[model samples]
Target: MNSNIDLKELWAKQETGIPDTKDLVKRVASFKRAHLKQVIYANILLLLVAVFIVLVWYYFQPEYITTKSGIVLIILAILAYLFSYNQSIPLLLKSSYEMSSADYLQQLLSLKRKQQFLEGIMTNLYFILLSTGLFLYMIEYTMRMKLPLGIFCYGITAGWIAFNWFYIKPKTIRKQREKIDGLINKFHLLTEQLTEKK
Candidate 1:
């Protein structure tokens, strides 16, 4: 009984390392701003690339229905991705300062779910559309070129696309999930510490 009391006293005196509410709020706000900027930059870059691809199709005019259909599908895919991205950004960037800790936590969880859905389902769809589009687009182009040159071009494009889809994209998604989960945990701990009796 005496040891238990001493342990309690010791724990009470220990610095928990959890920042005060205001500091935590500030930190979270800062993270939100940075994250929002990254999202916006990525979206804008992708939108520009999509436009560039469409422009190329309009000007160069690949000589097959498949090529035209491919370009259209690629445009559709990018637009769909952009729409989903825009919808989720507002949910993620809404200020949490005015919210109670519980509400804020709930918001974070919802944002995480939305992110997972986007990264998992939407990302896969985007890549599928991209691959199929490129394949269809290449059909006519490949026929006009020398056999060796055509093989080389197809081989390089396929390799690069495979590398991005199988490696880089999944790695990026995993890192994002980890970062969000870490933030959620930190906020959870901070809230618990703040609410606990000394």
Candidate 2:
């Protein structure tokens, strides 16, 4: 029964060739499984570090850090870590798309622009986040007014730099967004082709 379904024949036709119903279902399921495996492997070390954090907090926190401040510090650390890592989920998922379509080498080559476009969006999002963080940090610092004038000025300057990086980082945002937009169009084409094949 499996021998009857030819993936190449289905993929090539652009009409009625991209495998039978069952095969397509199986292929999508396989793709999802592969994606999950990649996510797990990609974060294996991160998972270990998280495990280590819990173990350390449980076993070796010193007397100085035993108070509420220590627990607050731990929570902040985990939140910061999660926020940064979550940003890369798409890129992580995308590694598969890199090697997923082996036979479609030319098509694969064509996906560079899409990849670049996605990256730009992601980068822009990162900058926006950073700028926001800096703005809040500045607010907190100014509210306290406890630091020396030099340190206060430095914090504001860093915030300005972060704002620039978010919106005006030379070359990166423009290039990445444009490239990914182009790729999105190509992906639309691919989806259309797949639909036609079906």
Candidate 3:
């Protein structure tokens, strides 16, 4: 009886360190808002780029079929990427502050899976299409240039693409994964705490 009382007192004295549900909900809502904003910004930028490319194609009107094909491939890559990227928007929109912890966790997991797919397969496809398109697109312009200039152009473009593929893309993916993983871990902890309390 004395040990039981001591245990109860110790338990009572211990700090829960658990965050308030309201605050957790607010943080989650903020995350959702930030994510949605990022999506919107990315979509707008990609669309603008696509429009710019189309405008250039219209105004320049290169004689070579390779140039036309390159332009089409680039546009197709952008559109395909946009379509695949937007697939996550609906999942994001489905999440809400009012959701139970378990539900929210499930939603986040789903979003993470979607992100993985985007980062892996879709990204690979986009880069492949873009690289091929760029090479094809440069053919016509480079042919008109002096040999040294044409070689320089190809070298610079290849270097840029390689940098993006090898460095920038991996860095971006790591950052994104860390952010989502942190959020998921927080929610997992919150769910466990809530469950224990019940």
Candidate 4:
């Protein structure tokens, strides 16, 4: 009876270091809202760009088959990316409040996995299609220009694409990964604490 009392006293005194449940839930909900906003903004921007491209194609009416093919490819790339990216919306829309901690953790893990696939394979595919489309699309316009002007145009475009692929993309992916990973780690710690309490 003395030892039991001592154990209970020690347990009561020890710092579990777990955050308040309400606070944790609030943080998770905040992240979800932020993520949803990001997705919405991205989708809107991409759709606007696609519409602009279609208008350009319709108005300009390029003579070259290559230019037409390039337009098609660019539009396809955007659509395919949007399709894949939007797949996460349903998962994101599910309320965290309705889920058990373990279930929520599993959802987060699944989200992380989906994000990895998007950032990895889907990203590569999008870039490849976009680059190829741009190159092809530029050919007819560049051919009509003087040699020096054509060279300059190609050079500028290539440099911009290279910068986006090499620098901007990696930085964006790193930031996104850090945000999601941080949330996953927090939930993991929470789950561990809950398990210990039992």
The TM-score leader among the candidates is 4
Clashing residue pairs found in predicted model 2 = 10-17, 10-18, 114-183, 117-180
Q: Which parts of model 1 have CA positions greater than 4 angstroms off?
A: 1-44, 95-99, 187-198
Instruction: Give candidate 2's whole-model lDDT.
Output: 0.56
- Model 3 alpha-carbon drift over 4 Å, by segment: 1-41, 96-100, 187-198
| Model 1 Cα lDDT, one tens digit per residue, 53-72 | 98988899788999898888
Q: Whole-model Cα lDDT per candidate? A: 0.80, 0.56, 0.82, 0.81
TM-score of candidate 3 on Cα atoms, chains taken together: 0.67
Per-candidate alpha-carbon RMSD to the true structure: 6.7, 12.0, 6.2, 6.2
TM-score of each: 0.66, 0.34, 0.67, 0.69
Of the pair 1 and 2, which is ahead by lDDT?
1
Off by over 4 Å in 2: 1-103, 146-168, 171-198
Candidate 3 per-residue lDDT, tens place, 50-113, comes to 8998898899988899988888889888987887778756656666768876777767767766
Please provide, for model 4 over 54-88, each residue's C-alpha lDDT reduced to its tens digit, 9 standing for 90 to 100.
99899999999888888888987898788768865
Worst 10-residue lDDT window for candidate 1 reads 86-95
- Rank by TM-score (best first): 4, 3, 1, 2
